[model samples]
Target: MSLSELFISKELTIKDSLAKLDKTAKRILLVMEDEKLQGIITDGDIRRWILNNGDLNERVELAMNRSPISVYEKDVKKAKEILNTNMIEAIPVLNENNNVVDIIFWNENFNRKLNYYKKLENPVVIMAGGKGTRLEPYTKILPKPLIPIGDTPIVERIINKFNEYGCNNYYMTVNYKKNMIKAYFDEKEKPYQVNFVEEKTPLGTAGSLYLLKGIIKETFFVSNCDILIEGNYSGMLKYHKANNNKITLISSLKHYTIPYGVIEIDKNSIVKGMMEKPEYDYLVNTGMYILEPECLHDIPANTFYHMTELIQHYIDKGEKVGVYPVRENSWLDMGQFKEMENMIERLGVSNE
Candidate 1:
């Protein structure tokens, strides 16, 4: 009934995975072609894929968790330690190449504490209608949402992160290559509910949100498809509600240091103070927001409207507006050329 007993090769059959599942560990190692990871097939993946008529004789590769949550080999022990600290039940182990090698089930380490964080009921509205002018030629063929980050599409990664917080309902605004985005999800048949609103003409950020005015009556989340904002999104919602604000702007504090000494002068006279490579922090809008439903009424129909303009409009009306700061690295903007390259390189965007 231990995790070590559930070990099995990717070459094994679903029958093997099922038999291994009985050994008390809900996870099984999937050793695939060489050291490369195929996936970790979970009992849930098997039960669901099978209920949908998955073959039993098929290799575990078919039911394996292709994008299984993993921690790098170097961090394996640390990952185990953190799991123990957080009281996580099961954690996947991965090699240097991010291949699934083992599973860490700390259920036996039992400290008797259940970490259950309640999630807010907010539907995620992704602004995927843009032509991605920043991404240029790549966007010509594929929309920003379809751009690959690591193994999954950028939008899928966003959805998965939100799903972790129990936010399943998603609304994506689409214009360019709308069919391609739809087709990609259609082929995958993911579990969450996804509704696409086609924009006949390009609507600047907040403008497209007007489409959901009636569809979504409660306060909801709005995020750009090209950027991945990582943090406790639920916490942001809590902040918004706590302040009783009409809108909450997710902001990032970016710190930059000057390479050379800088001087402060008075009236263009002698330098008063000087410092070398002093770091300065500035709050930058992260293109993500939580807005009350009534705010959507301000979005002009079929007109271009940026989120900034909406924020300004509300500010002018004396409506409460708040900014929640997130760490700079947490806001990943893959739309910019430099950001896209860095993300692709760091996350290994190529198919494995």
Candidate 2:
């Protein structure tokens, strides 16, 4: 990772730190203030805070470790020993000024990958029934699920990600160009089991989930075919069960910057405040959810219903509907042409 990506401000929210971590794909961050090192935070620290039900909006300083391990730049050669002895993934490199000049990860030069969680047997339900109107010309020829990100289709990539956690069983809801979706998979041999749910009629998002009532008997995942989320699937499931939530939505932190100056008016037409190009952060739904089998019963068969309505149903009934936040860049959405390009770029797909 770049040296700049490893540094963050103490004022940043835990939610923003999560985004930075996701963007860098690094498990740790160095909190720097006034050209000085303050502390360090890691994915484990954030996960612990989440499990304890800490507020995500809390300042990251609250979750950071005040004391951190470091090595001087002159003794950079010793960083590897420090990493191995401490059983840590990374360490900061400090200069004579005691400022973090660089950071070192144990596997910086290695190509090997690691898995932090054990295998999960839960099934995943991919919402592939939509016509993908936003993709337009591309959707006119190929279904959204078949649209390629890299060399593989987007839907296949989604399955492969979950498959890393040993989630082999999947039920895909198919409607628009359903035969193509089936044909493509039929021609290929896969280790995992793929079951297709034929939607005879258009059932908006959650409506088709009703078809899986009997088939899905445990906690399962629901993902939109056009979106990809790079997160810890096992962690999400753990949080869901820990909170006893009926459903847990995978949310992302999104920042929107206003281009023009904004003026605030009071009831008496007095200007309360004004700011130029202010940016606001919000948690956005990433089109992913973990749901208990019982939650499927709310959807009426053959009716067009959206997932938002189903979530609201549980909320109104006082059911435990929770949210698990991922990093902003972690959620790659291909719902639009622009985002599709971004997804392709992020996934390192060939435009040709």
Candidate 3:
């Protein structure tokens, strides 16, 4: 990839810069102004800003390193030493005019898969027992977990991503067409262990989790089968533990725009103001969570309970419940037909 692709303007929003990073599959970005390096931003910088609860709309400069490490010449030996010493991913090679001519990556092979993120060994639970009524016709034929996004099923893709983080142990709660879900995985020779938990009936999100109370004895991740969150899972865990949180939910910034002009009235029935197509932004839950083992007790046995109720339980008790936000594009949902199409497109899966 060209080094120019990682260039961003200082005024660019941290939210957009994150999206850019995901698109490029790279962590570092060069803040360029008139082809001159203004600053540098990395995934670590963004994580710090997020952990600080900084505004997503804030500019990159708010979280960037103004004085980034660079070299006057593209001397491989010197650049390698700097990268190793600093434990950084990439370094910028500057010309005499202080313009970035090339970028030297810690992984010399640009095409090689780079994993700057730590590999997590936490257990992951996939909520795959839902009837998947939203997916209708496809759900009629196969379980949502077994539904193919390309050649592989949605659940497998979720497992694959988690496997990359060294999380091999998995527990899947299953009810509707449980046999199909089991058969599909049974046929494959996967390296990870996927233990299936049978649910007698359709249990609400957190209800089935009660079955895993004794089985799971540590911090674990629970995710919906249809949504894939491509973020730093390892960092999320660290944030959860460091904050001493009981439960931490992964959220995304969702922006909504009203197509019509929005009108606002005061309490006195007076016309306060009008906004032409007002826009609203919110941190929306992405249906992924990291929870301490004890939090499982909040879910009563064999009862219909949603994750929201469990979250509220912690809030009601004044226990620490936190949220980690990712960009909107980073959370891919395929539960519905429209979102399934969007997910497929985003992953570049073949429609055929």
Candidate 4:
């Protein structure tokens, strides 16, 4: 695709820039005015802006890279050098008048995948306590986690993903149909250790985590049994440790296009502007997180508290809570029947 299609106006809101980024999947956009390059905005810039409490409705120029690296047409070779030297993905190509002419994308063949040979010793806590009300009849017979995605159960698939990353220890929080979940694993000779934390009643998502307070004395992962995250687990762990974040939430970019014209109004009831079928982009929580041991102290004991409330508590305390963004396709939600079918098809799992 041409770089011109990736140009977004500097006056556009940060929200608008995010939509542009998601639509293009280029990870960066050139901010232009009168066909002249003003600056550039990237996915990382937007993520940092959100982390620092920047308003979404603010102009994109507020968060754009004003002194971005660019190359002239004659310096095309220099583009590769800059990209390699700075370890950047793309660079803008500028004309004699400083107008953005094109964008030089790094060759995908040069991309190197990091080797995760080292095993991660951190414990992973899977919340399998919830009643699968959404997927009834089937869930009436089997617990949500025990539902088959292919030949393997959903929870086992979740465990296998972590196992691939060398996380051998698992703690499962179970309530409804807990016996079946335990029995299934008990019959098998598993490679990793599984410890069950039986909830007397249906404690909410974060409530069950409190049971592991004394047990987990380090940073660990918390995931919902019904969701699967397809991304770099090690990268997320590195980010959580590097930033010293008390909690790191894995978020997915979700795009919603409004099918009708939308109106904006002022306090005086004046029409500010009108947008036609505008698209909105959001970073939605994918029911996964990395948490420090200290975070467990905040969860009220034996109460129905959600992870969202726990996050808010930390936020209200002015604590550092980080968010790691991934592409929309990377998150697979299997809680509902439709999403489960989609995942089954994607994985080429035979329904028969």
Error of 1 at 232 (Å): 1.5
lDDT per residue for candidate 3 within 132-234, as digits (tens), equals 9999998999999999998889999999988866789999999999999999888889999999999998888989999998889999999999999877677
Q: How do the predictions measure up, each by TM-score?
A: 0.65, 0.81, 0.88, 0.71
CA lDDT of each candidate?
0.75, 0.87, 0.86, 0.86
Instruction: Give the Cα error of residue 223 in candidate 1, in Å.
Output: 0.6
Candidate rank order under TM-score: 3, 2, 4, 1
Candidate 2 residue runs with Cα over 4 Å from true position: 1-23, 32-38, 43-60, 67-117
Which ranges of candidate 1 are over 4 A from the true structure? 1-119, 268-274, 345-352
Q: Cα RMSD (Å) between model 3 and the true structure?
A: 2.8
Candidate 2's residue-wise lDDT over 104-169, tens digit each? 876663332232345789999999988999999999999999998878999999999998778899
Q: Per-prediction RMSD in angstroms? A: 16.3, 4.6, 2.8, 6.2
Candidate 4, residue 152: lDDT: 91
> What TM value does model 1 have?
0.65
